[model samples]
Target chain A: MLKFTEDHEWVRVEGEIGTVGISDYAQEQLGDVVFVELPDIGKTIAKGDEAAVVESVKAASEVYAPVEGEVTQVNEALNDNPGLINSDAQGDGWFLKIKVTDASQLEALMDEAAYKAYVEGLG
Target chain B: MSQDHDVQDLKRTPLHGLHLSLGGKMVPFAGYDMPVQYPSGILKEHLHTRDAAGLFDVSHMGQAALVGPDVAAALETLVPGDIQALGHGRMRYTQLTNEAGGILDDLMVTKLADDRLWLVVNAACKVNDFALIEGALDGRASLERAEDRALLALQGPKAADVLSRLAPDAATLPFMTMAELDVAGTPALVSRSGYTGEDGYEISVAADDAEDLAKLLLAQDAVAPIGLGARDSLRLEAGLCLYGHDIDEATTPVEAALVWSISKRRRAEGGFPGAETIQRQLADGPQRRRVGIRPDGKAPAREGTPIMKDGQAIGTVTSGGFGPTVSGPVAMGYVETAHAAADTEIDLEVRGKALPGRTAKLPFVPQRYYRG
Candidate 1:
């Protein structure tokens, strides 16, 4: 299941793990992704906490955690080519994988259809 | 949401419709609804400008003329640059100083004639600047604000090739020189200068002719419409200071690494506002000096990030971001004179982490201005 947050984060849930990254809308608004600071594999974070930091040529933005979880792994490929987020924001650009500790928290996120409607209103 | 100003209250430039047609993403800047980027994004726009040519709409800035008897001498009273020595067709960058040795604003002064001087100042400070200039030069000279004019900057390596095609005389103009010529059938004041450290021209024209001029420039295969996003990064990489970010009312020319703009005559005579304080700093050196910074890693240390030395706070970053040409993060900030030397080890406090950094020489990328 794919979910999105009001802050423009996205999470792809599979079994008990959720792979997180910023939504395409967020990446588009950011212009370009030059640098990305990701959380450690074992870091514990709560919902809405800053899980990663993305730097564009103009400014920096914090990527928030969509739900409470412990980080299990991070995408190391982004260290060299952060532009992957602009090219493949939802796929190869995934920031980290966290083992979801509270499944009920996922229910609060917007689904793909709902996120499209939400972003539409913003424009 | 783009800024504190309401969207309905934002002013649009002459090229506002053209910007929209080119898929520009609009953002508010200094009360104007300016384009921050186009469909190409800032990274591409910045690199493209370094390699090719980029056209920018800077009409939002205040344009005016100081005319009548002894205008140059009159202007010298408010600024530190040597206005009397500035030859015809030449331009000089100087600051509008306050009484306390701080910069009220920085602007370009172009000598059109002995009695006429053209000026370009920051958009946000125009109202205050006009009032200050008129009040100081009262009866000595006349301040004529040009509200119907538009300014466009054409910049990059290929800028000459694109601009010379429009105005043949522009091809021979050297850096810091201006000419009253015709560009695309419109009368313009063309100067071989710009904010980006590239060979370029700044054309001042009638507001009604702006869109046509922009379209003509953009029609060139090498020229693209660049927005504020790339302008910031380009200027940052060139080691130039943005007014509000890197310079302000509290920062003086000496501490901002802009002492070169102060002429030898002005430095000795000490006639302008805050001259006593400026002379003192020139002799004894300033408390803090602006220096370029390079983070050891990829993370960018943005504006307001504190500079650390052995866990002690020494200064703060005023301008910083990723440089598309240098392919790294670059920053400029003020640090104590003791630790301002090139290659001095420092740390940038971003968020809660102290990122390792070192003070580096300015213009992360080599400035390529064509003098001849």
Candidate 2:
């Protein structure tokens, strides 16, 4: 199931793990992504904690962790090609994968349909 | 209610409507509702300006005329430039200094005909700047604010080619020279200089006819409407000092690495405000000096980021961001004189981590001014 956070990060869950990346809307607002600072593997973080940083030509923004977990993997490819976030923000640009410690935390996030409506509301 | 009032209080330039029509992303800049970027975004707009021509609406800046027989002599007391020696049609870049040798603002002063001096000051400091100038030169010269005028800049390599088609006489004006001419049938005071380190012109025209003149310039194939976002990046790549950012009332000209703007005659006479301190700094060097910083990594080191030397805080970044032309991040800041040398290794503290950087020469990209 795909879930979304108000901070513009989206996550896809499978059993006990979740993959995360910023939404297309977020990428568009950020303009061109020049650099991505990822969290280290095995770093435990709480929900809403800053997990990564995305730098654009003009500014930098922090990417928050949608749910509490330990970072198991990060998109190493982003170090060389940060523009992947601008090109495929939802899929190939996934920032990290975390070992989901509490699956119940996902229940509070917005589903795909609700996330779409939320984005529209912002307009 | 206060937020709404704040929004309403923002001043709009003559090209406000045109900016909206062109999809400009308007933002509050120095108390004015100005376009930060258009639909093309900052990166593309920056790249486009370097390759072609970028038309900028700079009407928010303050323009004034000092009229008196001794206007130049009176003006010299407030600034450190050789205003009295400025020939007709010649403009000089100068700074308004305080008693402590600190810069209050940077401005352009042009010698016009008939004992008249034209001044263009930064938008953010205009109010205070005018007050200082008026208060200082009240008896010797009279200051007349030209609020009814609009200022526009056509910058880039193709600026002269596009502008020459409208005003043939503008082509004859060399860099740092100004002339009165009819541009597209509208009377204007044009200067062959700009904030962007490119061959360009800054045209001062009447407010009512600004849109018409802008449209005429935009009609040229090489000209495009550029907003403040690209304007900033372009100036940064050119290593131009932004008044409030790179320099302020707390910064001295010598400390900011702008000694070149201080003429040899002015330096020797030593009559301008803070001349004593400036002369001393000129002779002995300031404790801290402005230098360019190039981070090794892709992440930009923004303003307020601490500059570290051997695990100790040495300085802080004042203006830093990605340089589109250089295809990397570039920055400028004041650092201890010991670390101000080019290629000196340093670290910029970004987001709780130290990123390796080096002190590089100014103008991350080489300047291409049209001297002729």
Off by over 4 Å in 2: B1-6
Misplaced by over 4 Å in model 1 are B1-5
lDDT, model 2: 0.91
True contacts kept of each: 0.88, 0.44
State TM-scores per candidate.
Answer: 0.99, 0.96
* Residues B66-106, model 1: lDDT tens digits: 99789999999999998899999999999999888899999
Docking class for model 1 is: medium
Q: Pick by lDDT: which candidate is best?
A: 1
Candidate 2 residue lDDT tens string, B1-372: 001336588999999999999998778888999988887888888988899999999999999998888899889999998898899989999999999999999999999965899999999999999999989888888889999999999999899889989999888789999999999899999999998888899999999999999999999999999989889889998999998889998999999999998889999998888999999999999999999999998889998899999999999999999888998899999999988999999999999899999999988888888867
Question: What overall lDDT goes with each candidate model?
Answer: 0.94, 0.91
